[model samples]
Target: MTDDRRRRGLEMMRQVYGWEVGDAPGDFFGITVDHLFADIWSRPGLSMRDRRLLLLGVLAARGLNDVLDIQIPAALANSELTAAELREIAIFLTHYVGWPLGARLSVQIDTLIAEHERKRH
Candidate 1:
């Protein structure tokens, strides 16, 4: 049923992003929840951490720092990655993604790590 799928999608979204689902209006949101989260993200074989690492690489490669802003924090909250691991990811990715984008990702990672540390302490 549609409602069941929506519910599943919402739960998946929360699991993936640490986000609380609300009534978001729009076809795009509908598809994102119903299809992307429910169908795609909920599929088996890959762990959430694996999917996140792949996504992080894509986001970093494309220099999508805005999206990374959301993902990196979710990754931390989800315990999918640590601050040191994230920094290492940035460094490793820099060799492939090039310096400018790597720097951008590094800066974002550093900022988020500092924020996470501040919250913890």
Candidate 2:
């Protein structure tokens, strides 16, 4: 059963991040995979995109641009969000999260979009 959960979690990690994932390396990552991904992320209540949007809001509000660096690209690669949609999200977040973080998000979005396009071409 634990193995099954780990396998499901690895798959969920790949699906969520749009990247290849491997077995967890440590206790922290084990929990992240075996529980966070397998159980929480696999829950049926929300679509992946919806969960991502919620996560983005929380990350932005907390000024966690570094995490956004990972999430925005994954969101783009997964087709869960468009560049324009990201820009709009940044704009909307400005009202609630303040201008600095919003600006950071906007800039990060632009950078990630360019990077994604470059990698594709």
Candidate 3:
């Protein structure tokens, strides 16, 4: 992969994950950095914040709670989402995603919001 791709990927990772991309974890990280970020995400269309918000919805719907933990907090920290908007997503999803999954996501989002607030000070 080119140095330019690596640099852009690192910047996107920091913006969305709130951390630097460390030395490659393996081929997976390499592909993610080189292809996913540098190629796909670089395409002109959705903003970074738009991508993040859509990802949050998918993670919540799929019960990918661990990833949601990372994304929800990062999204808020990056100002890609507000606490209120996240809460609203949970509520709106209740009808489509069902109550049990939505309730769990709502709880997790609340916890993440609290965590983000605590880190601010």
Candidate 4:
């Protein structure tokens, strides 16, 4: 259970996404410990696209809009989703979660998208 692979994944998550799996609160600590991270994320069985689908649900369930703001672009960069696809998801989520939330999320997504374009230049 405790191994270098687990440690590496935890560290990489911290450096890349600022996800501190070690200092996680009681909420996430027991829910998704190193075992789950190693078993699921490290597995090659599912494609990144499928992984994003699951992550989206998790995000929505937790009402973590800010995190998803960052995540949508990441999903695109990882080839898990396209810009158009993300737009569609936003549209659909808006209907379900209310426009106010969607609007806020859209603003964040737009910033990320613009930053991405600028970085390419």
User: Candidate 1: misplaced stretches above 4 Å?
Assistant: none
Q: Order of all candidates by TM-score, from best down to worst? A: 2, 1, 3, 4
Residues 1-121, model 1: lDDT tens digits: 3999999999999999897987487899999999999999999999999999999999999888899999999999889999989999999999999999999899999999898888879
lDDT of 3 at 29: 89
lDDT (10s digit) by residue, model 4, range 1-121: 4567557557645433434546444545533546555456667777656777777656754579777876776775666677667667667776766777766656666777777678668
Query: What is the clash count for each candidate, in the order shown?
Result: 0, 0, 0, 0
Cα lDDT, all candidates: 0.93, 0.93, 0.85, 0.64
Q: Between candidates 1 and 3, which one is better according to TM-score?
A: 1
Candidate 4 residue runs with Cα over 4 Å from true position: 7-33, 43-45
TM-score on alpha carbons, each prediction = 0.96, 0.96, 0.93, 0.66
Provide the lowest-lDDT 10-residue window in model 2.
Answer: 19-28
Better of 1 and 4 by TM-score: 1
Q: For model 1, which pairs clash?
A: none
Q: What is the alpha-carbon lDDT of model 4 when measured against the actual structure?
A: 0.64
Task: Give the true-structure RMSD of model 3.
Answer: 1.2
Cα deviation in Å at residue 6, candidate 2? Answer: 0.1
Give stretches of model 2 more than 4 Å off.
Answer: none
Tens-digit lDDT track of model 2 for 1-121: 3999999999999999999998947899999999899999999999999999999999999999889999999999999999899889999998999999889888988999999989989
